[model samples]
Target chain A: MAGENMVGTVAIIGAGIGGIYLAAELGVAGFKLRLHDIDDARLADVRAFGGIDVEGERGGFAAVELATSDLRAAVDGADAIIIVTGGNAQAAVARSLALLLRDGQIILLVQGNTGGSLIVRRALDAAGCHADVAVAEMDNYPYSCRRLAPARIRPIVAKRWLQIAAFPGNRIAAVHQRLSPLFPQAVAAPNALYTGFTNANAMLHVANCVANAARIESGDIYKFYAEGVTPAVARLYEAINAERVAVAAALGASVPSLEEWFDRVYGVREASLVETCQRLTYNSDGPYQATGTPSSLEHKFITEDVPTGLIPMVALGAAAGVPTPAIDALVAIVRNMTGRDFAAEGRTLARLGLSGTGVAEIIRVMNEGFA
Target chain B: MAGENMVGTVAIIGAGIGGIYLAAELGVAGFKLRLHDIDDARLADVRAFGGIDVEGERGGFAAVELATSDLRAAVDGADAIIIVTGGNAQAAVARSLALLLRDGQIILLVQGNTGGSLIVRRALDAAGCHADVAVAEMDNYPYSCRRLAPARIRPIVAKRWLQIAAFPGNRIAAVHQRLSPLFPQAVAAPNALYTGFTNANAMLHVANCVANAARIESGDIYKFYAEGVTPAVARLYEAINAERVAVAAALGASVPSLEEWFDRVYGVREASLVETCQRLTYNSDGPYQATGTPSSLEHKFITEDVPTGLIPMVALGAAAGVPTPAIDALVAIVRNMTGRDFAAEGRTLARLGLSGTGVAEIIRVMNEGFA
Candidate 1:
């Protein structure tokens, strides 16, 4: 594989579960690795342990070639910098590496919200730094994992499939070729817009948490997708999916409905969205078995989903003349419920530097790749 | 008082808590009472008991005078007809009385949704029953009471105040004069629009039920407002309140904020909305203390609230160019959760015969009252 021949130093940013597991897999593939994060305690644990111990199905101790709190040293000679944090951490990570980024250092955001690349690029530009670097995002991480301890990670499941798109979308093949060893089932996505709408994390989680809010905050442990997404909540997920699909249509991007997303991702063949969700949620080996209901209404389902998920969709739908009542409704509820003005603070087109641009311009920018 | 001298026979519809209590109070006030309902079992109990045996601080037996399942016979020569039931049941009662209603009879809907009058008016007109019946509604029921048995209604406390309005707007004073004996502290509302905006049951219940969905479904028995309205849920309630206020402003109507409503009603001078709610909810005599947390999301909190409370609000806000994202979102959530099309099926401008009208026309209709 080209990824093997092209193997070189790789910097894994954010010492989260994804970062640790990614490092283990890539280390097993024989690439020199570096782990970086602002979490000093976590970094110290990684430093003390000398590397991450990944368990569950794919168990291994990947020796650390380097572990550092320093961002520059992490990427000094790396072929690529893989960011494995929530979209919430993307901008901060971007700013952290703004002045330190180098030429030919590709940056990839695993399961980024749309505009994540633009944000990093803008940070570099603001720092008066220019480099010959390619940037990309995946529709999802290839694994659903969590940290068992600061030095250990549990790879719950190898998600089997992922869609990748490069900013300046023409680089998908070249980028995919170099990244294939780590993500064996990687496929080329049409554009970031496609990946953006198709990112099912927020789509499924937010609606389920909101619909089953009582259950989630009831202090009872429950499976999120199985117990939270009753037949009724499933219908909401469907409507929200329809709105996302409509936004894609407005942008001239093609993606599967949320129902089909579950089908494609988990490889389940079911007649309805609820049935498919029920199956995936209850699967013992699946990632959701490791997930629990958010303790209250103030968790990531509202915090991450609002700003990154529904907010941009609502704004884009408004700009595209497609109504997103369902998305807008959730935004309002969370905004009021949380005292956060997500609409004012979220990932708007203006924030993404695509304000006042039409659909063609957006699609054109996505495909042509920015300089 | 003029209401005492003007009192004649009165028909009490629905035979629920409010209906039974109203019968008891008016029967003590020396007016002949007719308790009418389609509920044969409840009606049979009322008939066998011959009158209601009331308990609590206000204790005594008040003769029913007449208990019947026959709607026409009950209202044959009534001075006024008081319909006491959930807002969801209002339409059916309207249709049942559509053809049988006579001239000069005053029909008061205790806490009927605004559309309740419009629907009954439309029903009467559709039935070719052109009569001078004055259809009216109250801001809320005059008591926090429930039926212990079919023959017994325990009114925990008398709601010291109520605001009355009639459909034709001009008939308010006459209706008030005839109906005020049962509602001693009743005052004439500027219009039905004011009363509609101030209906707090849905706004508080829906948000609390949704935010505290876990606790309710967990089989915990608690007072709804006191136990469920955490700071976050209180914020959602405030948003919903703001949206309701915006809708009223669009209609040129003024209503108290939910916070003030609780203050005025409960006589608690609490500073925060949550604190006020907590106090009122824990007060043994407060209306809310009489209410229990909904058993499930499927209860009236979502079902009745979304349709009767939020659907009309979203429609009115849209027609008036007022953005009601908070109300719209709750409607979407509940609609999907219940598999119901509340917006399409619930009260709307079209249903209220104000579909294509602009803001000025809406205000005009609200002030002038529809004939």
Candidate 2:
């Protein structure tokens, strides 16, 4: 309503679980949609089939008018481009999207960690795409879906209160006014920083995986959350949450209690962190269990979470003179587990244009944005 | 033989699994022994049964002679007092032993941490028990066994090359000479610091427990070591080993590779850590698994290891200007799971009498045993 702009044509990049699910929703909603992915076979299958078969929750087969591997075909004439991929995959998408990004286009990164928006912006600028795009990031994806097949997704759980924020806090209204049609549940967060620290994916996934390393390695079939979130583990989860909140406070951001966030998103109202974890852990029939546990720590729990989720927190905390002992400790252990220097390789405070910046400066930069 | 004196009478404190096991081993060796524990019921059972029922590799029932709860009577005429309780329980034993300790008494702290010798020595000094005692500690116990009943122990595996070091490095030969009948395979370690850092129980137990937290919490019974020792976890073990070795090097002590130690203790000849873990883990019915995984993180793996094993490593590493990031990280995660400040609560550099001491001074203190 603010801009009187209807984002009719949207490009959904990355044919992963999130990508396919988003495309199905938009395609079913009667929006002109283009789906792009690096996988050639997947694109061909979707094109040959005329659309993806979306099942579960609200089931349907929605026609994707354009399904292509070509960047230009996907982005041309598109008002908005949503990158539904892991933080690691985002850079490659940004690298390719830079060449075809159009002026006034809106780019939204789902579950972007700190500096995620900045990295894409830099890539676009470096590629000479001088598109005056409104780049935004959500704290998490709106749906928990898994790929039933290459051209199909089973929508497991549709989450609520998804938090999205444009890179420059000022552009949030315009971005929200346009994309709200697709994501009606998403509310505008304060800024990119707010969404970055608000992410709970890494906090929940990493420790559970690490603690359950033996079980996962043994090739035992079991629900990940319901059984995994024991009272003891829930206690550990609280400590990590406290560290994250402290990091946010150091950067002049107030994060909602993880318990509160869990209740809001997953609908558990337990006051005790352990009790909440215990309740949700064994809900094997729930949306989270559909994905199953990763067979190895080499999966996203260590790979994506460590770099995107944890590294940024540590870097931000260090830049602001905060002692994130617990976060720092987990990072140290994980680096050895994966043999990767996440601090050097992941999204960092310096990359977020926040190095040497204090709380007030970080807040100011987040509001104004770098790109 | 420095003293040319045999330790005629020995006092075995703590009627727990290890204490009883040691008393059984020593009692079978035809040495005059007295067993003490806080639990009178356990002591009475051992006394009422006449001796502990030892069944396993070398099965036999040995008379315990006398078992009592009276600490004074247990220590009055003992030439040697052996404390075989956990790292955490060692302090209280030292506190009680301070009052009864006399000259020419050799106190052996089996598997005592770096602080073990120092704490007892300090307590004795404070109590004006100016006894010329040679306090020593073994890197680990000589055998892997558990108390099947209050008066029955089922030995799982008997290990060799038990590393023993007295508080004073010069006293190593003397201590070994005196206790050779009890531990024939024992060798002189560099010092108490060497034995302390060489402890691999926590390193193996903590990571495995933490990694397998989900499985343990779910009430699913599974083998801990063999099944728990996955490829990803093996990598973490190596990282922890590296940090520990780094700390050791900083303190001018050379530590063994965890792989070599496992091979030596468990007789697994696999070169790779993962392979070794796989080989050792499933021996579920074997000696190592006899200890089994704790039902919760509240067990010694977190409580004692974080403070005694990990915290001290980090503290010593910091004192010697070495970075123990991996050890620190695991400690952080475990602390949250258990909700205890291991660094403050457990054996620390300060508790070990090396708080402000530098590398040279620490080495010096190790050579010239305190008290």
Which one wins on lDDT? 2
Q: Please give, for residues B1-371, the per-residue lDDT of candidate 2 as tens digits.
A: 13447877889988877788888787767778899988888788888888888876677777876788899999888888999878888878887888788877889988775557776666666666766778898888787777778778777667766788888777888888888877888888878778878887756778877777767766777666667777768888988888888788888788777977876777776878777766664575346666576776677766777777787778888889998767777877777766777777877777777778888888888878643
Candidate 1 per-residue lDDT over residues A1-371, each given as its tens digit? 23433647789998866787788777766778999987766678778888878776657787777888888888887888998877778877887787777776788887777567766666666666677777888887777666777767777677666788887788778777777766778788767887787777768777767655544544656777666666666677777888999998889888887756666777775787666766776776666767767898778677777787788788778778899877777676677677888778778988776788777877787787543
Residue range B1-371, candidate 1, lDDT tens digits:
24443758889998866677788777766778899988867778778988887776656787887899899999888878888876777777777887788778888878766456666666666667776788888877677766787777677667665788887666678878777776778788767777777776666777877665545554557667766666777788888898899888888888788877766665675878778877776776666776766777778667766777677777788888999877777776666556678777788888777889888887777667653
TM-score of candidate 2 on Cα atoms, chains taken together:
0.93
Give a tens-digit lDDT track for model 2, residues A69-124.
88899999899899987888777788888777777899999868656887777777
Error at A114, model 1, angstroms: 2.3
What lDDT is reached at residue A282 by model 1?
74
Docking class of 2: medium
How many Å off is the CA of B289 in candidate 1? 3.5
